[model samples]
Target chain A: MFRYILRRILYMAVTLFIIATVSFFLMKMLPGSPLKAEDKLSEEQREIVLEKYGLNDPVPVQYVRYIGGLVKGDLGISFTFDNTPVTKILMDRIGPSAQLGAQALLIGTFLGILLGLIAAISHNGALDYTSTILAVLGTSIPSFVFAGLLQRYLAVEWELFPVALWGTFEHTILPTVALMIFPMATAARFTRTEMIEVMGSNFITTARAKGVSEYGIIFKHGLRNALIPLVTVMGPMAVSLMTGTLVIEKIFAVPGIGEQFVTSVMVNDYPTIMGTTLLFAFLFVLIILVIDLLYVLIDPRIRLTGGES
Target chain B: MSKLLEVKDLKVSFNTYNGEVQAVRGVTFDLNKGETLAIVGESGSGKSVTSMALMQLLPKPHGYVKSGEILFEGEDIVKKSTRDMQKIRGKDISMVFQDPMSSLNPTMKIGNQIMEGLIKHQNMNRTNARKKAVELLELVGIPHPETRLNQYPHQFSGGMRQRVVVAIALACNPKILIADEPTTALDVTIQAQILELMKDIQKETDSAIIFITHDLGVVANVADRVAVMYAGKIVEIGTTDDIFYNAKHPYTWGLLGSMPTLDSDEEELFAIPGSPPDLLNPPKGDAFAPRNEFALEIDTVMEPPMFKVSDTHYAATWLLHEDAPKIEPPESVQRRMQGFSNTGSKDGEK
Candidate 1:
């Protein structure tokens, strides 16, 4: 198990390094320079700004320089954001995104599982139909659309909560709810399918024959097995949600890393763009490893031997 | 012996997309205390449906007991609510299903599976239940009960998993243990060992067993009385000595002929001539008529009634009627039946 984990960490490092390299080249492929974003800057000032950041250097030399900076744990200064360190800027903006994403994930997942369990247990009943319809709506309609609907209904019309922008907990509610839709849909779909299959399994019948209460059968036997696949789907979904709430952040006017990423890319802020891409890659690979380790934890049959690597 | 369970005119049906399939059509049988009664039949013969009806475990919204009275200890289980059945199940009547591979929760410890009934029905504390679980595992002949208790079902072999299944069924000391083809999914040697363990456990616990299987050979070793089911009905039911030695129904002969006796030098194994009738459009008369080589003219027109062979034996066949032409069982069937008198003492004497 230890060897397997070591191997996975190594793979994660390689994956992040590849993402960093690729995104650096991709950012360089952009047409406009960061200095162009400053329309008011004089031609001489622009040249000085360009020289100050070593914009005249060859692509290979810049790539080597970036690699050296990475080795020293430096995600160089952002070109567009007053030459601020990309890492510090990202750190400052991470708070709101994390809070919103975490809230959506926890509540959405819990409710989704609850809904899925109800749908599976009741089978083809009204509750099942309703949950299925809700899942369909959540999946088909994007989060920004949900953002629009929540804003109009809750904040503007009913006065239930704030319409937009991040300030208090009330302001966080609409954006969190909008962001929650996709995860909720994915979780519900997986849970419903898995629970239905598990409920029909021979072990469930044996549990029933053993006089296990319906509550016990659904929660203990059915849900436990169903949870395995749910986690498998949720792990990757969690990484995406944690790292990329860009559009929802834009709609809600939240100062999140996703919003910064979009702005940095638009203005050709190479350092911030690469840092964000690398961060997303790190999270994706790390979560994949966590999911694999979790399989070993939840299922007794999946023993991660040293030979697995 | 006293009656432990009485299933009268028990009918089970499944409402499919096509229509209702009468899976178990008006079946009747009785189980006596400390006795093992084996119900033998082909697939879709309704033996499994009958057993599922006993536990009310039939698939809901699709399969259900159409009509029947399952009187266990004089209480009609047919009328019991889901909640009510929960109390009776796993406590008074537990089940051991076929395929031990899938019969246990793969994620759970076998010990906890065995302890669930003790905790639920007996209200035993965790410590007491854990202790009893170890004892139950040992009772089922599983080696190293203390260590095995903590292990998951996948960690055990197929035979050992079946042993754990039996341990779970016997956890609450149920009065009736309904074993639905318990040995069907096991190897031949393991089947014999499991049968032996069950017989030994019966001696120890005296729990009545409803053994459902298609294997006549298994029936001979474990059953006190044998009930041959055909097209969701019992065509022949008699004491083990009577069924094995003086079997009457053509279906019974067909079943017996299929068994490979160690000494018999038969070149080809006998299989029933045709598949069982589809229950969605079940034949109006004898459902086995198409498959029976000796099916009489009347068998095509009318279902035969249960005709008494002796005080303890009965057969649903026109051959047992006075008007039906006289015919003997086929040569291979007779060869198999001839040796039964000396070798068929299965501890289930009526």
Candidate 2:
């Protein structure tokens, strides 16, 4: 197990390097720079601005310098943000995004699995059909549109929550809900499909033959096996929720990295762009590693060697 | 002997997309306490369905007993509510299913699997159930029972897993143990060991065993009585000696002939001629008439009633009628009948 985790960490480092290289080049390839587009200036004036940020250096030299900066735990200065260190800028925004993502993940996953379990056990009953419809709707409608609807009906019309901005628990509720719907739907659909499949498996029949009550059979034999597949989806689901919060943060006026990520991209704030991209990549890799470890814990049949032992 | 379980006209059907598939058609039999009754048949012949119906363990929304009276201890199980069946299951009756790998929950420990029924039905506390679980594992011939208690199903080999499954079935000393091809997923040597273990356990517990399997070879060793099922109906049933030596039905003869005997040196294996009839839109009369070489004219038009060949032997075949033309069983079947005695003498000599 230790060997497996070490190998995964090594692989994560390689993947992050590749992502950093690609995003750095892609940002440089874009038509714009951090300099203001308004007033025409002398050629030497342009040279002064370029030299100030080391933008005059060759692409390969800049790439090496960027890696060197990363090694020293410096993400350089954000061009568009009053020359604030990119890492400090991200640190300020990280807390809100992380908290929002965690809340949505906790609520979404729990409710989704519960809804899915209810649907699978009832199976073709009214509740099953209702959940199926709800899952479908959740997946189909975009979160921003759903966010708009919630803000209109739940906030603007009903005054259940504050209209916008991020402060107080009530302010966080609407955006958190909006962010949760898609993942919750995905989890529900995955759980429902897996639960139904697992419930009909031969082991479940054996459990039934043992005279295990319906609840026991579903909970003990059915759900545990079903959860394996659900866990596999959770890695991507976490990444999606973390990154997918960008539009939601904007609409709700939440001061998270997601909104910063978007604004950084528009103005070609290279340091912030690279920092956020690296952060997203790092988060995804960490989630997948955690998920792999969970597989070992949840199923004894699955060994750390990545095969049945 | 006292009757432990008696089934009267037990009919089971599965509601499929095509139509209702009549899986078990008016099958009737009785199991005596402390005896193993083997229900022998091909796949889809309602052998497993019969055992499932006895425990009311059929798949929901599809498979159900269409008509039946499963009388256990003088009460009809068919009339029992699902809640009532829960009490009866694991306590009054339990089952060992086919495929040991799938029968036991892969995620759970062998001890927990066995103790669950004891805890649920017998109302044993956790500590007592755990202690009894170790005892049950030892009962099923699992070595190092103490160390094995916490191991998951995947940790055990196929044969060991099956023993654990049998241990779970016997945890509460269920009145009747329904083994539905419990050894089918095991190797030949493992199969023999499991059969021997079941016989030994049955001797100790004196629980009636409903052994469902397609192997006649297995039936000879484990079964006290043999039931020959053909297309959802028991075409023949008799004591082991009667069914093996004095078999009356063509299907029984076909089954016995198909099995290889130690004394027989025949080069070509005798295979049963045709497949079992489909239960969905089942044949109008005898379901096995098309497959029976000596089928009478009336066999295709009318279903034969179970004729009493002797005090304990009954066969559902027109050939048993006195008026029907006398037809001897095939040469191969006659050889098998003689071979049984020959093997008996050989064993006696040994």
Candidate 3:
């Protein structure tokens, strides 16, 4: 198990390195330079800016310098926004995005699992059909569209909560629900299908024959076994939701990292963009590692031997 | 011995897209205390369905007990509610399924799986249940009762897993034990060992066993009485000696003849001809008339009632009628019966 974890950590490092390199080259390859308004600067000023950031050097040299900066925990400076240190900007905005994303994730996951369990246990009944229809609607409609609808109706028309922005619990409701729809739907569909299959499995029949109560049979045997596949996707889903808040945050006018990242990309803020990309990659790898560790806890059959899960 | 379980006029059917498939049609039998009653038949003959029906574990919204009364100790189990059935299951009666690999919960530990029944039905405390679980495992011939308890199902071999499943079923000391082809998925040697273990366990537990299988060879060794099922009906039922020595039904003769023996020198094995009839549109008269070489004209026109061969033996065939021509069992069947008795007498000499 120790060997397996060590190997996974090594792989994670390699993956992040490759991601950093690819994104760096891809950003450099884009049509315009980071100096968007070079015509506004004097020739000497442009030279000074370019030389200071090592942009005048060869691509390989710049790449080596970037790696050095990363090793020293120094993400250079934003090209836009008065050349703010990229790390400071990220730290400032991360709190809001993490809060919104975590809230949506918890609410979405809990409701999805509960609804799926209900649908599966009362299979082919009215509740099952209702949940199936709700899942379809949730998946088909985009979060922005759902956000628009909720803002228009629940806030503007119904006056139940504030229309936009973030502070109070009521303000978070609309955007959170909008952000939650896709994941909730995905989780619901997965849980319903897996729960149905597991409930019908032969082991479940054996449990019933062993006189396990319906509650024990459904929760202990059915739901626990069904959660394996669901857990596999949950890591990616959580990260995706956090990253996917860009459009939702803009619509809600929430001052989050997603909004900052989008603004940085639009204004050609090289350091901020690269820093956020690395942060996303790091989070992705970290969540996947945590998920791999969790598999050993969830299932007894899956043993961590050498490098195999 | 008193009757432990009596299934009367039991009929089971499945409502499919095609039509209502009559799986088991008016099957009737009784199991005595501490006796092993083997229900033998070909695939799709509803032997397993009958056993599932006995436990009220048939798949719902498709499969159901259409008409029946499963009387256990004089109480009609058919009338019991799901709640009542839940209490009865794993307490008064328990089932061991065919595939041991799929029968056990993969996520659960062996000890916990065995302890579930004791905790639920017997209401034993965790510590006592744990100790009893080890004893049950030891009872089923598993070694290292204490340490093996912590291991999961995948850690065990196929035979050992099956032994764990048996231990789970026998944990509560159920009044009736339904072993539905418990050794079907095992190797020949493991099969024999499992059969022996079951016999030993039965002697200790004194529980009536409804052994469902297609193998006559297995039936011979484990069963005290045998019921020959054909197309969801018991065509022949008798004590082991009556079925093996004084067998009367043609289907029974076909079954006994098909079994290979050490003395047999036939070029090809004798297989019972034709497939079982489709239950969706079951034959109007006798379901086995087309396959029975000894089938009479009346066999095609009407289903024959059970005819008494002796005090303890009965067969459902027109050949047993007083009006029909007197006919003896086939030469090969007689030879197999002689073989069984000769071996039996030798064992008695020992």
Candidate 4:
């Protein structure tokens, strides 16, 4: 298992390097510079400004220097955002996104699985139809639309939550819910499908023959097997939530990295954009590794490696 | 002998997209307290349906007993509610399913699988259940029972997993064990061992076993009585001797002819002429008539009643009518019947 993890970390490093390289070049390739506002400057004056930021250097040289900065754990300085260090900016913005994502993840997975179990156990019944419809709606309706609806109804009309912004726990509720819908729906659909299959498996019949309580058979045996596939689907998704929901964070004014990511890209803030992309890619690979480990944890049949002897 | 289970005209069917599938059509049988009754048939022959109906584990609300009386200890299990069936299952009646590969939950520990029944039905605490589970693993011939208990099903081989399944079924000393082709998925040598284990367990517990399998060769090893099912109905049922030697139904003859006896030196093994009839729209008369070479003219229009051959033997065949022509069983069947006796004498009851 140790060797397997080490090998995965190596692969993760390679993957992040490639993502960083691609996003760096992709950002550099875009027209219009971070100096779009400086276009009317006198040629001599523009040169001074470019030289000050080392923008006068060739692209390859800039890439090398950027890579050097990366190795030293410095994401360079953001061109926007008062020239703050990109890493510090990312760290500062992480808390709200992480909290919202974690809350949504915990509540979404639990409720989705519960709803899915009810649907599968009462298959073809009213609850099954209800869950199916809800899954379809959740997948179809965009989170921003749901955000608007939640604001209008939940905050504006019902006065249950603050309309928008990142402040109190009440303000966090609407955006967290908006961010959670997709994961919950995906979880519900997958759980329903997997649980139905698990419930029909021969072991479940064996459990039934053993006179296991309905709850025991469904929760202990059926759910454990069903959760394997659910974990697979939920892995990459969890990473996205950790990064923050771009439109959702904007709509709710949560001041998360999602808004920063967009603004950095628009102004061609190379360091900030590359840093964000790298963070996302790193989390993607890391969560995938975590998911692989989860497979071993949930199912004994899934061995990590012969190295673990 | 006292009767343990009496299934009277038990009919089962499933509601499919096409229509109602008559899986089991008015089947009747009796299981003695300590005997192994083998329900033998091809796939879709309702042998499995009979067993599932006994346990009330048929996939619902699709497969259901259309009409039946499964009398257990003088009470009809057919009328028993699902809640009541729960109490009876695992405690008084348990089952060992076919395909040990999938019958045991893969994610669960072998110990917990065995202990589940003990803790649920026997009301034993975790410690007692754990001790009993270790004993069961030992009884099933598993080595290092203590260490093996915590391992998952994947850690065990197919035969060993099947042993665990049997151990789970026997944990509470159920009075009746319905083993649905428990050895069908096992290796030939493993098959022999499992048969021996079940027989031994039966001797110790005196539990009636309703063993379902299509293998006539396997039936000879453990079954006290044999039931030949065709198209969801029992066409022939008798003692091992009656079914093997004095068989009265042509279907039974076909089944015997199909099996290869050890002493037989036939150029080719015989196969029954046609597959079993579609139960969705079962034929009018003897469901086996279309495949039966001796099918009478009246077979197409009417179903034959079970004909008594001896006190313990009966067959459902028009050939058994008193006025019917006296035609001997086919040459291949007679040769098999003779060869079986030779092998039986030589091998001393294989």
Residues A187-270, candidate 1, lDDT per residue (tens digit)?
898899999999999999999999999999988898989999898888877875765488889888899988888888888888
Top-DockQ structure, candidate number = 1
Report how far residue B57 has shifted in candidate 3, in Å.
0.2
Write model 1 residue lDDT over B1-350, tens digit each, in one string: 89999999998999999999999999999999999999999898999999999999998879988888999999999899999999999999999989999999999988888888899999999999999988888788888999988898889999999998998898888899999999999999999999999988999999999999988888888888999999999999999888999999999999888887776674478888879999999998899999888988999999999999998899999998898789999987887788776654653443
What TM-score fits each model?
A: 0.97, 0.97, 0.97, 0.97
Model 2 residue pairs with clashes = none
Q: Candidate 2 residues A29-136, lDDT tens each?
A: 988777777368778898998899999999999999999999799999998877799999999999889988999998999899998988987899999999999999
Question: For residues A158-267, could you state the per-residue lDDT of candidate 4 as single tens digits?
Answer: 99999988888988899989888878888899999999999999999999999998889988899999999999888866975665477788888888788778888889
Q: What's the CA error at residue A220 for candidate 4, in Å?
A: 0.8
First chain TM-score, candidate 1? 0.94
lDDT of 3 by residue, A1-309 (tens): 888889899999899889999999887776666786779999999899889777899988888898889888988887776768888888988887888898888899888888888999889999999999999998788888998998899999999989888788777888889999878887888899999999888899899999998999998889989989998989978887876698899889888888888888886777888999998889889889888888989898887779554
- Considering only N, C-alpha and C atoms within 3 Å, which residue pairs clash in candidate 4? none
Q: What lDDT score belongs to each candidate, Candidate 1 first?
A: 0.89, 0.89, 0.89, 0.88
Q: What DockQ would candidate 3 receive versus the native complex?
A: 0.83
Q: Please provide TM-scores computed only on chain A for all of the candidate models, following their numbering.
A: 0.94, 0.96, 0.93, 0.95
